[model samples]
Target: MARKPGLLMAQLLNRFIWFDAALQKSLDIRGHGGVRRLESMCMVYVHAGIRRPSELARLLGVTRQSVNTALRELEAKGLVYLEPDPEDARCKLVHFAPEGAVMREEALDIVMALEAALEENLGRKAVDDLARLVSADWGEAPVIGKKGVGKAKERKKKSA
Candidate 1:
């Protein structure tokens, strides 16, 4: 609770690294090789029955456009079907096709393999806790990062 700035930053960086590794490796297994990483993950989840584009965007910490783009690609690939919402035609309810189920099962296995890798280093309890922490707070809060803050800016200041 009373974390030092350095400690908090370290935890944030660690979460970034672990999550990136988990999601990216899973996407690569799909071999669409042209796929956007996060979007592929979104498609897999949708195939698993998570539907709403807004919810997918919330889950992935991305914009709705990003999720929609991914869905469009997945649909074009014959993996998903998006029916215009009956009550809200502006929204689409994404559902997977039979072919989509095949890919979903494959992606699920890839994710499991990545989970095993994390367990090999961090044990299962720690891994589960990390997942729980992620699910509970997936970008529901805002970041107060300073504008124009970067290593480039710091290097320029040092040179000056």
Candidate 2:
């Protein structure tokens, strides 16, 4: 019999949690200070050229309020600052402070080192395959409830 889908998903989630915890520990061991995991994730997005709060929220799959709260904490830590968006006065752009730039660079270096270690432990091909699988599009989401499925079936019957 084929493996259950739920089992596979659970394994994947477990690995994600393990990796997250390991990365946090690695950061702390490197004396990078106590940067929150969410803050580091947001910084990665910022470094990748996502500057707007709304855009970060979309990329991170979180609420704008959540992103704003993280940004505020980062700002208070002197890691990020908000400025008026030149294109849109009603919006603000998140930028790294001078100290934040240094910290970002160091964090990136540490992440790269950790990835290299993971590649070594897992084998380069296996690591690459896992990356590809996660990045692949699995298709649109399925309708969850019986009521939604019934509505879909009704629409299909009407069309037919």
User: By TM-score, who's the top model here?
Assistant: 2
After superposition, candidate 2 runs with Cα above 4 Å error: 1-4, 139-142, 145-160
What do the candidate models score in CA lDDT, each in turn? 0.73, 0.83
- Put down candidate 2 lDDT per residue, 1-160, tens digits, no spaces: 6887769978887886676677678767766677776777788889889999999998888999989999999999899999999999999999998877766776777678877888999999988998899889977555545676457656677999
Per-model RMSD to reference: 9.0, 3.7
Work out how many backbone clashes candidate 1 has.
0
TM-score for predicted model 1 compared with the true structure: 0.63
Prediction-by-prediction clash tally = 0, 0
Candidate 2, clashing residue pairs? none
Those runs of model 1 whose alpha carbons end farther than 4 Å from true positions after fitting are 1-32, 44-49, 58-63, 137-160
Q: Write the per-residue lDDT of candidate 1 for residues 32-56, one digit (tens) a residue.
A: 3455666567765775678888889
Give the Å error, residue 143, model 1. Answer: 7.8
